[model samples]
Target: MREFLIIGSKAKTDKFSLNDLPGAGRIDILCRCVSSAFFLSHDIRRDVNVYLLLLGPPDPPKVIKIVGREVKYMPPDERGIAGLIRKALEVKADESWKKSSPGIYVAKKGLEELLDETASDVYYLREDGEDVRDFETKDGLFVLGDHKGVPRELEEIILSKAKKIIGIPTKSLMAEHCITILHYELDRKQLNS
Candidate 1:
């Protein structure tokens, strides 16, 4: 399965207002990234995993994992998505790594820990990196940053751990857009192979 990690530098760990998801001021981008990661054509979903490294709130840092195939109900809107994530976090805050539902898990581990545990090859997405089309397509983990981009310290760690630094050869797309393009490219390559 393909894995995508989104680092939310200011995403709150606490519960947020469902009515004001965009105005809630904590998880707007996080919600958007999640929505993009899971959305597909004709309501079909992709078999993938999304990891959110939330760095805002009372707890500071927390990792939220969502499995696509296991998701019982995926919200089409940012508000509902944010609510789902908020509820998941609230229900699984204490667990180190426990399933709150069929497709969702909350873990105490941060980005570094999660990357180390995954057996898939890790690829860090950046504009200056090599073009993805030129690289061999395979099941792997793709690490991305939120609006503000990955933190400097974490980027350093990611660079060291990544099997490759892949680029899209554009002016830098949104995290979700990057996912879609990468999946399309990889899927096409797989089909041809």
Candidate 2:
């Protein structure tokens, strides 16, 4: 596995609206509010590299989503949401950067802090348009993304890892969430790896 990207978030407003968008194969997961069955759902795209942006304050120790009958948890705090989203956007703005860096990316910085030490290594990218910080953690490496969703660059690695979790052939996409990988070489490599 390239790495494990566990995104713990409370507000997934953007992810919920993805079905309304013109696309396919998003994360194929859902982020839900605590104590609620409501969730943000998107299918893993076969073409574009996409992320679900949460539109709300960051909070943790809460239920974020129910992906495939599994419960995904959040940090219980969202104070860092603004900063995380910005960095996520920066990653999305440039997929060319992925060939160089690879790791997990998420939408909230607070979530990074909440990840149990079990997380061996993580790549945390946080941006605010005012600043873009990319971090690599060889041991317990974690990053906090605020506004923008997981960048395409980092998504490359997450997509690779996702296959290990779900064991299904995944589709690839561009930074804009458009189906870009017709022959999905990246997905192929991820599956093979």
Candidate 3:
């Protein structure tokens, strides 16, 4: 499976209204990231997983895990996905993951703990990294930052753990766009294989 971990540096951890997703530290961006990660023309990519690492006010460091294979009732729109995230935030969580809704899990885990849990090859997405077109695409974990970008300290840790830093051979792009491009590359590789 392909896994995506998006670092929402300023995304709110507390519950947010569906109407204020963008204002909620650009939760809209995170929602879009989710949509891009799993949604296709007529179906959801059940083999993918999207992780949102939210670090914002009131409460911080909430990780929202969306498992595609198990996820049901996920709407194709941004507002609908945001609703799911809002509901997840409402559920009280500890270090352990708590299921708030179908296929959505919330926890108080931060970046370091999450890195420890994933056993897949970790690839950090950066504009200056190796061109994605030059490498083989396979099942692995892809790490990226939201609009605010990953924290400097956390980025250092990511670089240390990443198997390689991969990028689309272009100028800086939006986080969601990067996800779409990555998915396209992976899909092409899958089809050709």
Candidate 4:
């Protein structure tokens, strides 16, 4: 299975106004990334996993996990998506990785902890990194940062843990677009393999 780790530098870890998915001026981007990761040609693909690291108010950091086939309450728009994530965060704060609902898990863990737990080959997506097409592709986790980009400290952690840094050929693309392109490339590789 393929996995994605999206770092929401300002995404809230508490309940948010559904009407304003941009609860912290960046939650909307997280929603879009989730949508792209879960969507397939006709349905949600089962082989993908998305992890969102929220670092906003109420709670500084929280990890939200979405497993495609297991997610029972997917939202069609950014608002609903944000709501689902907020709901996940509503769970009691004592647990580190508690399942708030089907296919969704909330934890106090941050990006570094999640990456260590995943134990998958990690790839950091960067604009100046090696071209994805030329690099060896495998089933693993892809790490990306939101609009403002990953914080310097976090970027350092990612660089230390990542097996490689991947780059798309074009200018920097949106986080969601990068996922879609990576999926297509990986899919093509699987077909030919």
Q: How well does each candidate superpose onto the true structure, as a TM-score? A: 0.91, 0.26, 0.97, 0.95
Clashes of 4: 0
lDDT pick, better of 1 and 4: 4
Clashing pairs in 3: none
Candidate 2 lDDT, tens digit per residue, 1-193?
1222333233432222333211211222221111111122333221112223332432222212112222123221222222233233334322122211222243233332333322344333322221111111112222222223554654555434321221112332122121121113334544555
How far out, in Å, is residue 134 in model 4?
A: 0.8
Each model's lDDT comes to: 0.80, 0.27, 0.91, 0.85
Give the Cα error of residue 38 in candidate 1, in Å. 2.2
* Candidate 1 TM-score, true structure as reference: 0.91
Model 3: ten consecutive residues of lowest lDDT: 130-139
RMSD (CA, Å), each prediction: 1.8, 15.6, 0.9, 1.3
Model 2 lDDT-worst window of ten: 129-138
Candidate 4 positional error at 21, Å: 1.4
- lDDT by residue (tens digit), candidate 3, 1-193: 9999999988998978788888899999999999999899889999999999999887998999999999999988899999999999999989998999989999999888998899788999999899887769678999999886778999998988889999887798999999999888888888998
Error of 4 at 154 (Å): 0.1
- Point to the candidate with the largest TM-score: 3
Candidate with best lDDT? 3
Ten contiguous residues with the weakest lDDT in model 4: 16-25
| Candidate number that wins on TM-score, 1 or 4 | 4
Candidate 4 per-residue C-alpha lDDT over 63-157 given as tens digits, one digit per residue, 9 for 90 to 100: 89998778886865788788788788789764377887789988888777788898579999999889989877768899998998889999999
lDDT of 1 by residue, 70-171 (tens): 887777677777877887778746537777666878877777788888888999999888998998966788998878888899899899899999999978
TM-score between candidate 4 and the true structure: 0.95
